[model samples]
Target: MRDRRGQGAEPDAARPTERAPSVRSEGAPAPPERAEAVLPEGVEAPPAADLAALFLLLANSALFHLGEGPDAMGEAAPVDFAQAQFSIDLLRLLREKTEGHRSPEERRLLDGIL
Candidate 1:
């Protein structure tokens, strides 16, 4: 009697299964290598100390009007004493907010900056 499923419906155990085609071509070129980042002239990547120092410098510039030089386009900016005081106050707030979370060294540095 004929099978009820239909003729040739059963998977042939002797035949090899077909595979999907590869996505990459065999002759494709290798991917390009990544290069190191280039920083601006006289500027190195910032370290942890540099970040703290940056805030200090900004506060000093506000408080003492230092580092007020001509811009890249030769334009000079007027110093705002009020803005500097605000930055100093913000730094104070940061110290208070981060109070128990900082390491001894970090706390010392922050305290010195403040």
Candidate 2:
């Protein structure tokens, strides 16, 4: 058959099937999907420049030190009250220093975290 470029073309049956490229490197198995990777309908990703996200990140660090979060091996680490207190203090100082520079929602979130 003649292709659009007026060149001879292989018969359809003789051509190899095409596929979408794999996201990973060649020969690598596809990564498994984790429930945390997907957001529920109508939910949106956190904004890149969000102050609320920064507040939440520090809060989570405190929670981790308090042994409420998993460790590197996904096991609960021993509670370290000092570290936890430090994290909370840092978060508080950040909120205070950024006063009047945050949106109403960001201020509310920071207050709630404290």
Candidate 3:
């Protein structure tokens, strides 16, 4: 059968195929580059900034003042639990990202947490 390129061949399913080229190559000619495309107005990109400081600040504050239980105001309940969950999740993410390069302080905190 004729392929899309007009090369006469059997159907791809019936033929043994070679592997496709990798997206990146070693010592290959650089691909043509394009100008950075500006985002359209109102397009919201994900925030790629340090949320750690904020998380750590709130976590520390809550841990210090909240005293580890649901209190008279009940404000501490959700905030404390949510902060704990977020810190645990963040620690897991950090471990996965760093592949276990955590600092001693981080390890201590994470050990206490988990």
Candidate 4:
């Protein structure tokens, strides 16, 4: 390799090093905090963190399998009857299992999906 010293490249010892900000006082690594979420432009954020979100997520999966949702290429996925049925069944199970515990709006959202 050609000499890099003459090209203004610093030796490793001359470069300043940075300590990672997340270390603990005892020198063991600190537990990570939940990082802020970032999303691509035009993509919707995930649903609110609740049962409604679960319901919506499962419902979305069902729709995706049914070819009603976008694929990785942003086009509608091909129909997958078995997978679609499985997703629907999962949604139904969640609905039944959470019967009385669901909020009014959640019940309506799930019911609408079904």
Report backbone clashes per prediction.
Answer: 0, 0, 0, 0
Q: Is candidate 1 or candidate 3 better by TM-score?
A: 1
For 2-109, candidate 3 gives per-residue lDDT tens digits of 456534477556777798787868877898975655789998864434434434554564564445655567644444556666655765676567556656676665
Q: Write one digit per residue (lDDT tens) for candidate 4, span 13-92.
A: 88889987654678676679878689999989865689888877888887888888789999869999898898889998
Best of the candidates, lDDT: 4
* Tens digit of per-residue lDDT, candidate 1, span 1-114: 867543365657745779865675778776687565689999887554554665576566665543366545776756666776777788788788878977777678878777
Q: Please list the residue runs of candidate 2 whose C-alpha ends up more than 4 Å from where it truly belongs after superposition.
A: 1-47
Task: Using TM-score as the measure, name the better of candidate 1 and candidate 4.
Answer: 4
Candidates' RMSD to native:
16.0, 15.1, 9.5, 10.0
Summarize candidate 2's per-residue lDDT along 12-95 as a digit string, tens digits: 677789997757678888678645557788999756656777888889889988989788898878899999999899998998
**Residue 57 in model 2: shift from native, Å?**
0.8
Residue 109 lDDT (model 4): 94
Task: Evaluate all candidate structures by whole-model CA lDDT and list the values in order.
Answer: 0.67, 0.83, 0.58, 0.84
Error of 2 at 4 (Å): 70
Candidate 3's C-alpha runs over 4 A off are 1-13, 30-34, 39-87, 99-114
Q: If scored against the real structure, what TM-score would every candidate get?
A: 0.42, 0.56, 0.28, 0.57
From the highest TM-score down, the ranking of the candidates is 4, 2, 1, 3
Q: What is the Cα-based TM-score of model 2?
A: 0.56
- For model 3, which pairs clash? none
Better of 1 and 2 by TM-score: 2
Query: Where is the poorest 10-residue window by lDDT in model 2?
Result: 2-11
